[model samples]
Target: MLLADFIRDGAARLEKLYPSPEARGLVLMLCRELLGVTNYTHVVEPRTAVPEERLPELEAALARLCAGEPIQYVLGVAEFCDRRFVVGPGVLVPRPETELLVAEAVRTLQEMELDRAPRVLDLCTGSGCIAWSIALDIRDAEVIGVDVSETALDYARKQFPQGPSFIQADVLDTEQAFPYGPFDLVVSNPPYVLERERTQMRPNVLDWEPDLALFVPDDDPLRFYRAVARWAQRFLRPGGVGLVEINEALGPETAEVFRAAGFKNVRNLPDFYQKDRFVRFQTPDNQAINN
Candidate 1:
């Protein structure tokens, strides 16, 4: 089959779910990844043909896309912080916005005193994207990622041969004691989407992503933020910093959770979209602020 024809057909089938340009982009990406063809290959080489043996595989991938499976999950990888992280049915696909949380955490760690190796903790560390990103970017940084789901932990643990230590524990289990602590930084991108917000999400996410990693009760949408505060209080060192991605609608409420936990310098930070997407705070200490 001609490569152009395949892409045209795939994009048309995918248009039912995605916009025209986006559908075309998905088809292009699929071709690039699976066929090693550049996006402009079909346009520049109109006679390019997809090998007969690979046609079936391409068709299978297009079918999955047309059925509402996310491209990342279908490809079994999601790019975050310029690195690829494995993702699948049981694990949540990392989002582009979550990269902001990683950027903030990386900047905070770099600005702090590096007299000794910095310690970091990541709560509800689905796929360990943030945790691994920080560890890889910061030399000798001790990072630990905690998640309740064994499936998520498995994916997180395998992301790097020697990155953050991935542990299995519930973020909401206040009574459970974590063996490692006294971190210089605490970070999380926990479950902040309210159940009622499902109507606002796309079917690909609703049908494919892990619900355990994406949602909270509408009546208590701030539950994960409250849990993050508890983890920060217990694990973060004096004057240490904490950052977490949040639902834009509850920015102030989420920040209040950290402030009420006795953190100072609590503030909501905007993402690329300028939405109130993250909260950063400092654990109380008499030490002078490190500029």
Candidate 2:
């Protein structure tokens, strides 16, 4: 079958789900990844043809897309921090904006003059993207990721064969004793979306992504932030930093949670869209003299 024909038909079928340009882009990406063709292959070689034997597999992929399955999950990988992360039915697909959290954490670690390897902890790590990204970016850094779901942990643990240690623990269970401690940096992108905000999300996400990694109760939208603050209080070393992705609507409140927990330098950070997407806080320097 001709590549152009496949592209045309696939885009037409996906038009109802995505905008015209986006549909075409998805189709082009699918073709490039599955058939090893360039994005502009059809443009450059209008006569390019898909291998007859490969047509069935391509059609199967198109059917999945038409059914609103996310392309990343359909392809079994998602790109984060210029790295590919394994993702499937049980784990959350890593988002581009969460890369900002990794960037900020990396910058914080770089600025600190530590004599030994820096210890970092990631809370509610669905796919260990932040944990593994930090581990790979920082030399000799110790990184650990915590998640409650065994399924999510399975995916996170395999992301890097010898990368961050992925552990199973409930972040919201304050009563449970967390064994890891005294981290130089603590980061998380927990469930910040409120139940009431479900309408704002697309069906692709609502249907495919893990709810445990995506949402919070409507009455307490900042629950995970509160838990993150508590975790930082116990695990973060003096003058250490904490960063977490947050719901845009609860930015100020989320920052306040850290401040109220006695963290210093608590502030809200913006994502690429200039929205209140993250909160950064620092633990008090315990060595400072209290004159």
Measured by TM-score, how close is model 1 to the native structure?
A: 0.97
Residue 172 lDDT in model 1? 92
Residues 59-172, model 2: lDDT tens digits: 999999999999998889999999999999989999999998999999999999788999999999898988999999997999999999999999998897787888888888
lDDT of 1 by residue, 71-190 (tens): 998888998999999998999999899988888898999899679999999999989999999999997999999999999999998887898998888889865767787889989999
Task: Give all candidates' CA lDDT scores.
Answer: 0.90, 0.90
Residue 94, candidate 2: how far off, in angstroms? 0.7
- lDDT score at residue 120, model 2, on the 0-100 scale: 97
For model 2 the TM-score comes to 0.97
Clash list (residue pairs), candidate 2: none
Candidate 2 global CA lDDT score:
0.90
